[model samples]
Target: MGLFTRLDRASVLYNGMADRLGVGETQRIDQPAGAAAYRSALLRCSACAEAEACAGWQMEHARADAAPGYCRNRGALAALRVE
Candidate 1:
C-alpha cells in the first residue's frame, strides 16, 4: 500500500478503537493522563501488523469490552475503558 493509505488505515484503527473504548470522553475528563495514554495507544496502533483484521473487527462490532488479541494496542485500549 501507499504511504497515505497505510497511514489512513492506522489512523482508522486508532480512532475506531479509541471510540470503542470511550477514550475521547476519558481524555475530556482527565486531560493530561488520559490524553497521554490515548496518544501512546495510538502510537502502538500505528505500528501494528493486524490492520486488516482490526478494521474488519471494528466494523463488525459497535463496541467491545476488550480489543482483539492480535491488536498491538489491546492492553492500552482495555485499560482505557471505563469500568
Candidate 2:
C-alpha cells in the first residue's frame, strides 16, 4: 500500500472512534502552517494524554474539510480525492 493509503486507513480508524465516543465538531484542532510545524505537532500529539480521542475528532473534521488536512497537532491524514 501507498503512504497516503496507509494514512487514510489510519484516519478512518480514528474517525470511527470519534463517532463511538460522541466527540463534536467544536473539538477539531487548528491547521498548522508548514511542513515543520506539522511535523512538530505530530510528535507532540503522539505524547498527548488524549491522543486517541483527539485523533478521532481530528479525523472527522478533516474528512469534512476535505482532508489530507494539515494541523499543528495531527499532521496530514489524507489527500484530496481526485476525479
Candidate 3:
C-alpha cells in the first residue's frame, strides 16, 4: 500500500521469480553492469503493475526454464541463466 511496502513486495516477487528460474546473483553481480541490471530489475519490478500475478505464477512454478510472459524482466532474467 505504501512505497516501502510495494517495493518490498516487488523484491519478493523478483527474488521468487529468479529462484524459480534457477538464476542467482552471486555469479553475475560481481560485475558492475550486472549489478546495475540487478538494481534496474528491482526498480522496474517496484513499478510494475503485474506484481500480484507474478506472485501467483511463482507459487505455481517451483522450478522453471523461463520467466512468465508478463514478467517485465523476462528477457533480462533469461539471459542470466548459465545455460
Candidate 4:
C-alpha cells in the first residue's frame, strides 16, 4: 500500500474515525495513480485478468456527493495487466 493508502484494519478504522470526526479527506485515496499502484501491490497474488475493470468498478461504486474530491482510486487510474 502507498503511504496514503489504508487497508484491512487501517481502512476500517480510518473510515470509522473519519466519519466520527467529519474529516472524510483524512481517509480518502485521492491520488488515483498512487492508489492503483498500492492496490496492484496488494492484490498481486490474485490471478484475475480484470484488474482494470475491477478498478473502474470500484471507482464508480465509491462515487458519492458528500466528498466529490475523495476518490477510492485516487485519480481514477487504470490497473496494470498481469503478464
Candidate 5:
C-alpha cells in the first residue's frame, strides 16, 4: 500500500481493536504518557505482520475483554481500557 493508505488502514485497525476492548477513542489518550503510547500503538500497527489477522479478529469480536495475543499494542490498549 501507499503511505497514506497504509496509515489509514493501520489507524482503522488500531481504532477497531481499541473499540473491541472498550478503549474508546485513540485521540482521547491525551495525557503526555498516554499520547506517546497512542502514537507508538499506531506506528506498531502500521508495521505489524499480523495486520490481516487483527482485522479478522476485530470482525469476529464486536466487543472483547482483551486484545488478541498477536496484537503489538495489546498492553497499551489494555492500559487505555482501564483508564
Candidate 6:
C-alpha cells in the first residue's frame, strides 16, 4: 500500500481496537495521560504487521477486551481500557 493508504488502514485498526477497549471514553475522562497513551498506541499500531488481521478481527467480533497477540500495541491499549 502507499503511504496514505497504509496510514488510513492503520488509523482504522487503531480506532477499532481503541473503541472496543473504551480507550476513547477513558481519554475523555482523563485527557492528558489518556490521550498520550492513546496517541502512543496509535503510533504503535501504524507500525504493526497485523493491521489487516486486526481489521478482520474487529469486523468479526462485536466487542473485545484486548487486542490480538500480534498487535504491537496490545499491552498499551489494554492498560488504557476503562474498567
Number of the predicted model whose lDDT against the real structure is largest: 3
Compared with the true structure, what per-residue lDDT tens digits does model 1 show for residues 1-83?
77667667777788887787666655533745766665666667777788878889989988777888898877766666667
Give the per-residue lDDT of model 6 (tens digit) for 12-68: 888777787777764633756766665666667778787768888898977887888
lDDT of 2 at 23: 34
**Top TM-score model:** 3
Q: All candidates' lDDT scores? A: 0.73, 0.40, 0.83, 0.37, 0.81, 0.74
Kindly list the per-residue Cα lDDT of model 2 for residues 1-83, writing each as its tens digit.
55565455445544443333343323323333544543443454443455455555655553343322233232333221122
**What is the TM-score of candidate 3?**
0.87
Once fitted onto the true fold, the runs of candidate 6 whose alpha carbons sit more than 4 angstroms away are 25-39
- Candidate numbers, best TM-score first, in rank order: 3, 5, 6, 1, 2, 4
Which lDDT tens digits does candidate 3 get at residues 1-83?
A: 89899878888988888888888757447545776777788888999889888988888888999998888989888877877
**What would the TM-score be for candidate 1 when compared with the true structure?**
0.71
Q: Clash number for every model?
A: 0, 2, 0, 5, 0, 0
Cα displacement (Å) at residue 20, model 6: 1.1
TM for candidate 4 is: 0.25
Quote the lDDT for 15 in model 6. Answer: 75
RMSD score of candidate 6 (Å): 2.5
How many times do residue backbones clash in model 3? 0
TM-score of 2: 0.34
State TM-scores per candidate. Answer: 0.71, 0.34, 0.87, 0.25, 0.85, 0.76
